[model samples]
Target chain A: MAAIPRLTSRLRIAVTAPATVWLRGAAQSHTWNRLSGGGDRPRHLDLATLARLRLIPLVGFVVAALAVPVTASATTIYAASSLSKVVPSIAPGNTYSFAGSDTLAFQIENGAPADVFLSAAPLYAERLHSKGLCSTPVVFALNTLTFVTPASNPAGITRVQQLDRPGGYRLAVGGKHVPLGIYTRTLLGKLGLGRALTKNTVSSYQKASDVTSVIALGSADAGVVYTTDWYANTTKLLAIPVPASAQPLIRYEACVVMRPGSDTTAANAVIARLSSLAGRQALFNAHFGLPPKT
Target chain B: MTFRTGLFLGGLVVTLVLTFLFLLTPIAALLLQVPPRDLPGLLRDTAVSSALIVSLKTNLIANVLFLSIGTPAAYLIALGRFRGRPVLLTLIELPLVLPPAVAGIALLTAFGAFGLFGSTLAGLGIVLPFTQAAVVVAVTFVAAPFYLRAAISAFAALDRTQLDAARDLGASEAMVFRRIALPLAADALRAGWAMAFARGIGEFGATLLFAGSVARLTETLPLAVYAQLDVNLDSAVAVGLLLLAISGGVLLVAKLPPLWSSAAPSSTAGGW
Candidate 1:
């Protein structure tokens, strides 16, 4: 820790030396006379002087940046993209990074500084748990795949049957490895429309939120997204119902990641909040299903 | 060496070495993740091959377009003495600084389905958002500024007296430009194009947002890395390494002395 300040100061001195030498060269140049002052001394500085002046603030910024301390007490929660809105709202103070569940898991496996891990599916949580990167998974909330179209309904897509035909309309789906995509593909297969709809897919985003955005922006005629995501964007999108029988099991799981130097108590509190009754109410308000009875 | 000179040189070398280590660590880590024997199998994935082909094809066409149009634009701005030239220069360089996400959204609002000219494009039966052309447009929009900025600097650095002497010798303005300006600026222009091409090759956010990440259709190498992340982590790492290699190759080719030295008036000219 003591060496850090010394190292940064050394770096600062090293960077500053060249700029000073270059500035002196510029001040002596003939172009400096023509450009600014015609040999007038005051306000006669060249581009290098101005550049060096700019460097003062930048140097201060780097020093200030190095001086600032990292807040180890603040927890960082790595959650799935589907929980982008709700998780932050529920756990407002801590840092949050939302993406595909698998991507978050991959990041955790590779040593991200995540205090808590919230996955949109059990598979990722289980994988992390098995690897001893996280605690045993606990189901927190549930979601189901549904078709969503832009409010403008560009292709006039209303019924689920419209998606069963290839080239019927431009579709956005999640990537094959992402939980949303896996659930979407499973549901489509259950409905016997996987192959055809796969043909129609124009984009397969790794993040579930991207699917919603594409449809909401009217870039794609429709896309598959979680019921919660559709509910969150009710104004921009209209939803098409999925047959109950065709709905794949969509669960969100949370676990405390075993990262070194993290606030485990704070991490545990976040997981507890998600599994609590208030958490269930928040999830319900956002249209997420409660975990079915054991 | 004098004490002051020695101190300055020591500081400079320290900074240089620090910067090199900072930049090279990530590359070294990326290389370590993928074993050499796994390269062929990773490249064999049809999706990987498709991404490579798409990136190369779109980047090639985009580079050609950049050289043709960007060179002239840079020349005009650097020497035209026209009104609003600063504004034009600023606009050209704007995309270079704009966030990639912002660039993507801007492109969508200008050329998207519901954008200003969306209906006009639709009237022409043209849909661009999910097509390969959209990928090219995204790359062109984000990458053109690199070449343009470099080209402008190259042109601006040329000696004005030589141009005037050519005109005094009864050479046409166009002839002077073709013979004097182009040759003098060739090395810098090549370097700039390499930068733009490299940027285009690595462009992901804008292309994904504008063109949509369709396999083999709109997916570039960076997009392939992203798309394959969880489908196969090894494949993702392999694709990332490929992009790094390609970008490094571009920089290397741009630096090769013999290819650029032919046009130089002095050995040190265009050394950058």
Candidate 2:
């Protein structure tokens, strides 16, 4: 009889402890709910709390109805390394853009998202087209290669053939892979001046801008850069003619990257602008030559 | 015990794993990508050889200049009781706060063709821009502060009593500095040297602006890596891997001496 009373007392203590805990939890939750703005609580409570819940799915449905997928409206253009000096002035609305033809090609090959590509050379554009990474490319502008000298013209390098003079003056050229550099080498080779020029060429830079900076800074006696670049830096540099045998006509090309099921209207509009009179004027203003009549 | 705690822990672990994945995987991939056969040919390239030699020579010169000049300057800023000490310290550390590009511009404004010293230098027939000398100047500008800051803290932590004691024993001030101060500050000096060397090696923006990238002349390893990337992607990767390997070796050499000493516990059994 004594053992039964002891057991009953222990049971009563356990039951009362749980009741106190439940009351405390309820008061705390109510205070929190009042402090906050009575935000919605989870409806799917455990079996112990199911009797006090209300069901509502309309709020979630309303939020779902209001949501819309966002798509990028701006076009990103990746331009060639040499065009960096001039392309920014022509981009529509100055949307997100990156410059560097080789870098851009690498980026595209690595699947970087870009809408359009403008190359300093047709070969790169053709390569991208053949790889199915870009649509058919069109030649957009023509450029003439010119030998640039510092304003002082210490070496008096008036013509391209002087690039081969013995004990020749130090010259800066673009890296072998850059389009302008490759073209320059081809022209030098055609004139039988490649070997002699190579001996005097002190360094090769990766960009035309680098070559221009060198010439402007008087680090080199002369360098080859675009006519546009020469005009842009007229005060610091003077352009001397590359002999007809040593100059190559350079052409620039642009292409739109085809995206599956996406509207090509904006891209086609940009292409149209390239062919328009105002666009040609913009090119002329940038010191680039007009596209050869055809 | 609750689901929220479990979710939080899971999220923390995921973040940590992702950080490791993003930062370390590329380096790991580089090591894996380099074939053993190509290493010899890649290292033998005249440009690569020249770049490596230039990097070492320039960094050594930079380190020496940094220590010789920066140590005393740092000590003065750290320990001197002057009205403008805080301001002076801030001025000394200004380069640390400036972006590398801004540092380049700052250097140019002071030393370029249209700069304060430019016309005078031109009169003397001293061209400081776009030359090997310019490379040294640019590296010094960027890397000196790393040594200076380390040295300042090291000097500040030194016990003044040791120096006073040396002086009281009739030792010359130079002797005290050489024997007492330098020995005690050896570790800090080593750390400073490491920082200066690393900074010199990694210096790009200031170098590009001041020295200009001229292959085999002004081009250091980083510039070489950039130049190679333009001509040959494989060669670029090879250079990058070489840089990575050298950096790894430096870190290992810095740490392994201590690890080896600890590992050979028996070697220290007779130590006083």
lDDT of 1 by residue, B106-213 (tens): 888888887788889999999988888988999999999999999999999988887787777777888777877887788899899889989999999899888898
Which lDDT value does model 2 have at B158?
82
lDDT of 1 at A172: 87
DockQ of 2: 0.19
At residue A127, give the lDDT of candidate 2. 82
lDDT of each: 0.82, 0.70
lDDT of 2: 0.70
**Candidate 2 residue lDDT tens string, A1-294:** 344334445444545345435433543464434533445753332312311111112222344666965566766677765566455556566344555577677777767666777888887788888999888998888887777898888668887777776757767777778777887788778778878555673566667776787677666778888777788889999888666766687888888876564335666667667667777778878778777654
lDDT of 2 at B134: 78
Measured against the true two-chain complex, the DockQ scores of the candidates, in the order shown, are: 0.35, 0.19
Candidate 1 matches the true fold with a TM-score of: 0.88
| CA lDDT, candidate 1, residue A210 | 79
Q: Kindly report which residue stretches of model 2 are placed more than 4 angstroms away from their true locations once superposed.
A: A1-71, A81-91, A154-160, A165-168, A190-192, A259-264, B1-19, B97-115, B122-125, B161-172, B255-272
Worst 10 residues of 2 chain B by lDDT: B263-272
Candidate 2 local lDDT, B1-272, one digit each (tens): 23443443465478689799989999887766768688778768999989888777777777678888887777777667879877877787888878876776677667766568877887899876667777888899888887888888888888888778667777787776666666666667667667667777878777766676666667888888877877777777888887777666665565444443333222212221
